[model samples]
Target: MARTSIDYEDVYQALPGMVALLTPDLVFADVNEAYVRGTGRPRESLIGRYVFDVFPESVNAPDAKNSHHLRASLLRVLATGERDTMPLQRYDIESPEHSGDWQEHYWSPVNCPVLGPDGRIRLILHRVEEVTEFVRARGLGGDTAGRVLEAELYTRARELQELNTRLREAHAREREVALVLQKAMLPATRQMGHRRAAVRYRPAVGALNVCGDWYDLVDLVGGHRIGVSVGDVVGHGLEAAGVMGQLRSALSATSRVADGPGQALNVLGRYANVVDGAESATVVTTFIDFDRHVITYSSAGHPPPVLLHRDGRVEFLDRATDPPLDARPEPRPRPEASVAFSPGATLVLYTDGLIERRREDIDVGLRRLADSLSHHRELDPEPLADTVLRELLPPGGATDDTALVVVRL
Candidate 1:
């Protein structure tokens, strides 16, 4: 009969808690998976390395320091040939990938002397129980395990404060980039031949990300017709802004050759199919023909444009709308509607951010927008745009990118 020898190394590695064996000189002889994960160091890098050298306080700082308390505890275990329970430790480690930023960690450690057959200490059984989460949850370590970890917890609190500061700085930089991108997409106010047009854009105050809302104007070759566009790409951030820029450019180019808003939107549908992640968009494009004194407009799953008449009559330029970009394959032709522009009349083209509310139906928002416009119908173009926003939105304003273009004839 044959007997198989027990694999003691495999057994040691299978321990559930963090466990390690240190040589008499305090060098790592063995370590378990739990210990490797908790330290965030590979077993290969830790083995045969001095404990203090591997986990120094700061690797990139000019003043490199060693763990004096850890060294003292190990020496005590070796000299007395007995177990020693260490107090809560603020063993900060430098993250090489993070440019040597200090990562605060707390641990309850114990060292037991392993004596040889000749009654001399040969190895130390080092075990660590991590208590970082417990300390953070309690907001302080004083109440944790009879107030033993209060002093160390103060250091952890400082680390958290520093982390929050870094995050706020990053958010500020992001907001700046978003503002720049948004400004690049929208141009200054201009006159398209005979018609006067003005644009207004406001970014969400509390939103961390930027939205894709834009307005564009392009004059036709004959100088008698002008194309006006307002669109909203769903979602927020750099990707949305990028798509908004592309669509605005595409609509402008398509308008140069396309007949009217219906044809321009149909061409834009084809462009959306090729753009990655640009699944859906809503738009209202209008062609102002000064020769005929009429405006032709179309909607593609967008809120209709509000038309204010000289006689104080308010009407929405709504027609048989096509789906948003990429919403349906082989969609029917986008229908175009024409309305005669009266003298001193105003047209308001805007994104849904002007009227959309968080918990209310979209129809309610539309009615509110119409009511506001009817109340301020006599105001000039610049003040009219301002009044509509001031009335429809809250005191703090919308939490999404808003683009408003007002045309006064």
Candidate 2:
């Protein structure tokens, strides 16, 4: 067999379906040949204009609501980053042959978001199947009874569509509430003073932007010391987010008073035992003393932090590791370790979502993380954080929540 390369642009242009690409703000970016022919507009004319401006609702049919429904669907896709299938819509397009006239059209439309590497919506794909001929045929029979039956069916469909819209609105409201709660729990990252640092939190795609991952950076009592931690609770949605908040707060408070990272996590483990949905949670904490040039660290069955040297050497801080929170029936002291780093070295801490992949050995994921850090060791903390995420995350985005923290010594 011979191998052949495919030109995706050619395929997109040759697609039989009417398709158009629009910016997140609804300006047209590109249109397929079918779309140009279907709308009776030239490709050049349609490419740069706003979708509604190019296909305005007919003034003759004021009640048609052609633009209103389509705009609503596209906006929903933007808000949720999910595909939206709209019910059959009655739209009127300007007649190409007669400039002053409008022709009735019916369409089955779907709007979808094209996500970027960071999981944000970059573009909107709008595809529609013209159904004007089939809809007209439903009323073409001379029999009065046939036309009346078709009308009833169309009314029933419209009612169902309205019901679906209501349900979607309800879901959106619930997601909004959950998102607000999560944001309230996670504090914004503050300035790291002499040491530079960056933090990023990404929730799972299609999980309503709520998950169990969390990261915290706290300024210790002394000006030269700071505490940084990342953790993952065992579930998703409101329950996991609530547990994560509680655990993170508990750890933060313990770190402020405890003698070391081990003592802080031991206190957190005891608190986790009483909190529902906190069992088997994994967390890693590190307290950096800039004056001492030391990093004291402990992990509760979480992945080890990476220390990337300026010479492209990577070190995994895994000497002190213990089981997850509430894993042991009897409370015992957690282990802690300390490592020294030179100036310009970087410290990277993250949740499992940064490395783990479905059905793959964890060592491979760990190696991949180390390789990325070694290659990009020269970048500063902020760009290092962004670059690591861009390289480590799956193309469609992580299925689990990810929290990342990067600091330069």
Candidate 3:
């Protein structure tokens, strides 16, 4: 069936959007009142005229986009049997009723083939929509995105600040308990005339703030040796600290009977494995016998103590170690290594935290500590250890906690 042309004047007045019927080559076969008002032209000027000639605004050379890509889009529909949307400019014309000279417009151009009495495509329908007010009224996409980002940043900052407060309180409380418990498990601070001790403890860095590093010195009756040790139990928090306390207690009691470095560590390993009636893994330990001339030491997987000789030579001294005491049902046999102390030498017994840094760049930190010890040969053990902790370790609290036992020979 053919689409008979209704009364053309009545159909023109009925259209809501700017509507027109075009020939295959852009000749205007018919148009509506809305199209006349949008283009600001008299209806007589447009009817039966070529669309390009009447509305020069919508025409462009084949290579260039016209004012709003209106000409190109109509060409696309004809070539591809498709429709396209366009925003304000040439394709859309403003209504005469609106006062604002500025327009925000959109064009939804549709080309439908109108059949003739012969029943094949004869004319094409082109519809243009003007949505100028809608476009101009809203904010820019970039501006809206910035506002949302700022709001999210504010939320994140608030969450971070609250977390920091909670962390500080929790860490302060844990450190208080850990410090008191750790100090109580060992003998009271006593300075042996032959040995001056300097100890420093700080919480771990970041929020967790737990450490399990401990050291002790017991003055033996025979003036035979200084019973010094450094030990690490397991992890970074209170559990490691608690295990350290149990081991420290066991070391103080057992060291009284063991005469040699190897014997002392053997006793410690056995006791740590069985303490509290539960057999567990062995903690790595270093026990030192500091007599005036020579220092004998035994280790259980602990890093060797660095000896700072009075002549500015540095040496890390320790024996080959078996695994930790509680690693198995039966502990690996302990080993001992001895070195004669350089006159006025300072021995540094430390945990991994002393040299370890984030990103595993411990070699650089080791060199710094070794260089510091070599450069400052005359500084006493107490001040020397303090300086190393303050300068060589990462600033503020450490990523892992550090413990140091400095004995001078």
Q: Residue 266's C-alpha lDDT in candidate 2?
A: 96
Candidate 1: worst 10 consecutive residues by lDDT?
A: 57-66
Clashes of each: 0, 0, 6
Ranked by TM-score, the better of candidates 2 and 3 is: 2
Q: Single out the weakest 10-residue window by summed lDDT for candidate 3.
A: 58-67
lDDT of 3 by residue, 260-378 (tens): 66777777777776664223333333344454567766766666678788888898774555555555566555777667775467777777677765445657767777898888767
* lDDT of candidate model 2 versus the reference: 0.86
lDDT of 2 by residue, 230-347 (tens): 9999877888888988999999999998899999999999999999988889999999998898999999999999988888889999999999999999989999999998989999
The alpha-carbon lDDT assigned to residue 313 of candidate 1 equals 84
Q: Quote the lDDT for 238 in model 3.
A: 66
Q: Candidate 1, 169: how far from true, in Å? A: 3.2
Q: Let me know the TM-score candidate 3 reaches against the reference structure.
A: 0.55
User: Which residue pairs collide in model 2, if any?
Assistant: none
Model 2, position 230, has a per-residue lDDT of 91
Tell me the deviation in Å of residue 230 in model 3: 0.6
